[model samples]
Target: MVLSELAARLNCAEYKNWVKAGHCLLLLRSCLQGFVGREVLSFHRGLLAEAPGLSPSATCRGGSRCSPRARQVIKCRNEIMHSSEMKVSSTWLRDFQIKIQNFLNEFRNIPEIVAVYSRIEQLLTSDWAVHIPEEDQRDGYEGETGSYLSASQVNEVKIELLKEELEEMYLQAEEQEMLPEEISNRLEVMKEFLRNNEDLRNGLREDMQKLDSLHPPNPKRDSKEPGRETPERKD
Candidate 1:
């Protein structure tokens, strides 16, 4: 299975544990494509945006935003999953597989990426059946839902459902007089359970650790330093 291969490619202990998280990403991609019945980039972007804490990293290792490595994975996933009249060449798929392996290797070491992975896993595992379509099930697909419509009929159904949800949210926001920024932030938090948040979970793990693997907390590199730590919150 692709999931097993992904796990084997990430040999490190941290990566081994994160395999479940990677599986979550693959599942989400399949679910979104199946539900929307379209493989367009905007649809992909919209689904990901709505999911809490599920954004591709624009920067890596002090490099430029939307780094080539990240872009390649996104492109590869789209091409492979959305194979159409202009089918992706086998050569590209082979190269993309290697890129994905390398990308996961780099991704496993970064705390932010780890956080994103965990958050997505939490979301998918919690309530995925409501979004994925039954007709979208392929050979390897494994989601907890039955077929509702044929693949051809799925797009219209999903579009109408999404439209109603968006309208309801808009009306609710207007009723509450929430600002645009506040509404956006609240939407991200809505998908996650408070106790299962990465920050709280990681903080608890930190307290139990015999040693801090990231090195002794530096006063100069305290939580205040940009990119050093997430902002601290009172329990």
Candidate 2:
């Protein structure tokens, strides 16, 4: 019924500029469908201003003289408008609260995320002591020691080197006055690379730690027997 009224109002040349007028009527129609519609309607009508801005009194224009049905319609319209406004306001507030809660949750997790990233960085950059064979130690060290390094460790070093190179390139590009857009694009790529590197490093560290803990390092054995004496000591 409200939709029909809106269509009629819109079709009328006199109501072309009264688009807002139809909105209030539409709200009333929706409110009337609910179980509390009658109560809501009554409350709004009682609160309605008679004759535009005047209080409901005998002296108010048509306030005391309107027919019962006309008065009911007027009251219903007022309630519909108020209820619509309240619904819009409440919906907006709920959305705003949800957004605020999400922002707070993100803020709270930032420190823990940063700490994990730091741990990842430490693990990536850590230098493990490689024990060279007795023969290899005597020869002049040429390339990287053949002593085995974990694949994760090598990848970490590569990432660190790439980061340093990227920083240098960025500085050089800035010095040469590269276009702002290009510089921004390059920075974005660098940031993405760093983020990926951190993720990879963290995952590798976790896996390695788990493996190490599962199979602990073997205890060292004494080079000499407790009851045995060295031949040189016999002299």
Candidate 3:
């Protein structure tokens, strides 16, 4: 919401079509055109060092950058993502909400964009019910689909967990200079599953690309007949 609006406000006609990218701020930084800190976005958002690039912005507290709200939020995001747990305490979430809310308010002129504040509150507060197929399959199981987290969140969580595990397997294999058969099979299965699920595929598009790079596909082998095996060449 914010990216598209920023693009509109900036009148970036040449770069209006690049939306829905997964690397949230990286994409924004590309379109920033030196608006904020240019080269040190990575460290600026890190909240570890003081830099002038992210300063004097609507979202950042310039000069006295003990803890700029934008940097704080970005730091928390990195913690959640790199921790691999993808979990944050309720207190952390409430603090995050406050910081992000302030950032969002800076662009309150965009009504459509500001409306996301309510939606974020809704998602943050909503209870996610676990679906137990064995119990749900009972003759008189009546459940309200609306009583759970949005489908996108659920699907993303599933794919993220799988991706985390698969990534670990691949990393371990790469370090050993070998790809285990089990890891190879798991990678193939994940590729197939992602191929079949468009929502999952698009949501994790960048992640999937990185994962593929870790284990490049053999198109020749894949295109061959099911019963025919490609011969390995030895020098």
Which candidate tops TM-score? 3
Error of 2 at 152 (Å): 5.3
lDDT of each: 0.40, 0.38, 0.47
Two-way lDDT contest, 2 vs 3, winner: 3
Model 3: per-residue Cα lDDT over 137-216, one tens digit each: 22112344223422344444545555555566567667855555655666676667555555555656766666567667
Using lDDT as the measure, which candidate wins? 3
TM-score of each: 0.23, 0.20, 0.37
> What is candidate 2's lDDT per residue for 1-235, written digit by digit as tens?
3223323322333222111222323332343345245555675566574345645443423344545444554553343222311122334333333432332244344443333333323322232222223323311122432223333343444344344334444554547666555544554454454444453344344333433343344569988889997668554
In model 2, the runs with Cα more than 4 Å from the true position are 1-147, 199-235
Write the candidate numbers in order of decreasing lDDT. 3, 1, 2
Clash-forming residue pairs, model 2: none
Off by over 4 Å in 1: 1-64, 86-89, 110-235
lDDT of 1 by residue, 77-114 (tens): 44432222213333553465466555655657544445
Alpha-carbon runs more than 4 Å astray in model 3: 1-67, 130-147, 150-153, 157-235
- Lowest lDDT sum, 10 consecutive residues, model 3, at 13-22
Candidate 2 weakest lDDT stretch, 10 residues: 13-22
